[model samples]
Target: MASSADDVFTAICGGTFVYPAVMHEQYQDIRVTNRDGVTLGSIREITYGHAISRMVSRATEEITRIDHTSRTIESRFKPNALSTFNEFIGSDLLRDPSEVVGQNL
Candidate 1:
């Protein structure tokens, strides 16, 4: 294990509603060991990059879905929904998780 990448990925996939609980459960099973059967490190780096990439992909999908839904709603009924969707798509908080994953091995 290298970093808490798996936790981050789980959080993203589960969405805002369930990520917190799933992350806590996953964290409990994380561990590290060496060749001699000795505990060397306890970081969660085993799937960091994969997790980050998954998060980025999922975020992109979510943004796309929101954009489509907003456009449909605006064209058919409500205009105010566009503003909310735009705000969510434009927010700086939803960043690519891959950038946070370390590259050095």
Candidate 2:
């Protein structure tokens, strides 16, 4: 449903590369052009593979934080009585699906 954030920003500003979510209902924006002529094999290399994993994580996190119902990300606008202070919490994928793949590799 969501597009990967790989081509988002520069390296200094941490980038994310989201993976495909076949079950999602929304359609990703079409980007058919090959800007740098990079092939699928090149993108599947270790560096890019890692990037994709990280992007998928960011997309999930952003969704949770942006979704008003989720309340996963702490917000400063929240009533000052909920807790001592709002905290920024990043996603932690425990026992990830890719964990097995990494171990085997």
Candidate 3:
């Protein structure tokens, strides 16, 4: 039975002819072939780890963009609604209406 790392490596390599080496220093043993079955390159053992990190970084960037866009839209609309309400009720509407009711107790 293959280990989890072996499965991950196989999936990334996309072939059954390759094998994962026990020694991390032997990363060069993992062969990568081109479509024409020619040796292209050998990825270092750290390559997979780097790939995963890059994916996480991209996801975080997209999330930040979404959050910033949402806040900008909210800021633009909130002031418009407040201004419209103030205009409808007169600029002094923000003041206490109790003064007009004659209840200065």
- In candidate 2, stretches whose alpha carbon ends up further than 4 angstroms from where it belongs are 1-14, 21-33, 37-105
List the candidates' TM-scores in order.
0.14, 0.15, 0.14
Ranking by TM-score: 2, 1, 3
lDDT of 2 by residue, 6-92 (tens): 432222124323334312211112122222212221111111112223222111111112222542222111112222211212122
Model 1, poorest ten-residue lDDT window? 56-65
Give per-residue CA lDDT, model 3, range 65-96, as digits (tens). 11233322101101111211111111223334
In candidate 3, where is summed lDDT lowest over 10 consecutive residues? 55-64
Candidate 1: residue 91 lDDT (0-100): 23
Our model 2 lands, by Cα RMSD against the true structure, at 17.5
**Regions of model 1 farther than 4 Å from truth:** 1-30, 33-45, 56-99, 102-105
- Kindly report which residue stretches of model 3 are placed more than 4 angstroms away from their true locations once superposed: 1-3, 15-105
RMSD of each: 18.8, 17.5, 28.4
